[model samples]
Target: MKFADYYEIMQTIARYGHALDAGTAPFDQIFTDNVELDLTHAGPPGQPGPVIKGRQHVLEAMTGSADDPHTYRSVLTRPALSHHTTNSEIVADRGDEVEVRSKFLRLGNSQPGPMPILIGQYLDTLIRTIDGWRISRREVISHGP
Candidate 1:
């Protein structure tokens, strides 16, 4: 991959957290039309999480709607909540497609101090589009709640 491609890919990954935190995630910029978000391992321990499909559904899940209550809007709207990413590695690059593995940390500050709410790794498959690199699939593996 070219240097510019690598940088753009990293920026796209970082944008996910920033947009979500801002509550103005541009789903089209971050994900493909048929995106698959596998949160099967992102829920509380011993519970089966959801595997959201399609960009529109993903938007509803993240932003919430009157008809859809299973959303991350609650946690995202928390004043003290923030998302951080580190250790991004491009595991594969085939010009038009790439795979990235990265670590994510969710933190919350309240009362006395800030604390980690969740730690996990993101396995993402991104495809090049006319707009730029967009994630086609994202499988989140949680290490802790």
Candidate 2:
């Protein structure tokens, strides 16, 4: 019900997005000690899947170099894809903590013949710690059929 709180949440979301966009692992300041992420991503085994429990686990699932040899070799993994969030709907509120549902799109990756275009929504639970607001649990739902 407060504009300041709304702005803070928005900023927090933007920071997370920027971290991923810059292809850098998000610092520990944005996690709730036990951050959980259910990523609907793949990268040919020993590379990707659902990572829960720690932010480090999520980082391994996401962090990579655009100039990496393997990525450069893979036709499907080239050209790259970026994610954008929209239609954020705040579903639950607990004072400084809340849960939001939003639609996300993986835009513009031309490589990977059959791009696993991610067009889906996420249910993210966020909390405000002593540092700031952080993602507590985020459940991903990828579209199919």
Off by over 4 Å in 2: 40-51, 64-78, 111-116
Worst 10 residues of 2 by lDDT: 69-78
Q: Tell me the spans in candidate 1 whose CA falls farther than 4 Å from its real position.
A: 66-75
Question: Per-residue alpha-carbon lDDT of model 1 for 1-145, expressed as tens digits?
Answer: 7898898899999988887677666677889989999999987788868999998887877776524322246436588788998999999888899999999999888678878999999999999999999999999999995
Clashes of each: 0, 1
Candidate 2 per-residue lDDT, tens place, 53-108, comes to 76665554455333331122222223455567788877888897898888776665
lDDT of 1 at 30: 87
Highest-TM-score candidate: 1
Judging by lDDT against the true structure, name the best candidate.
1
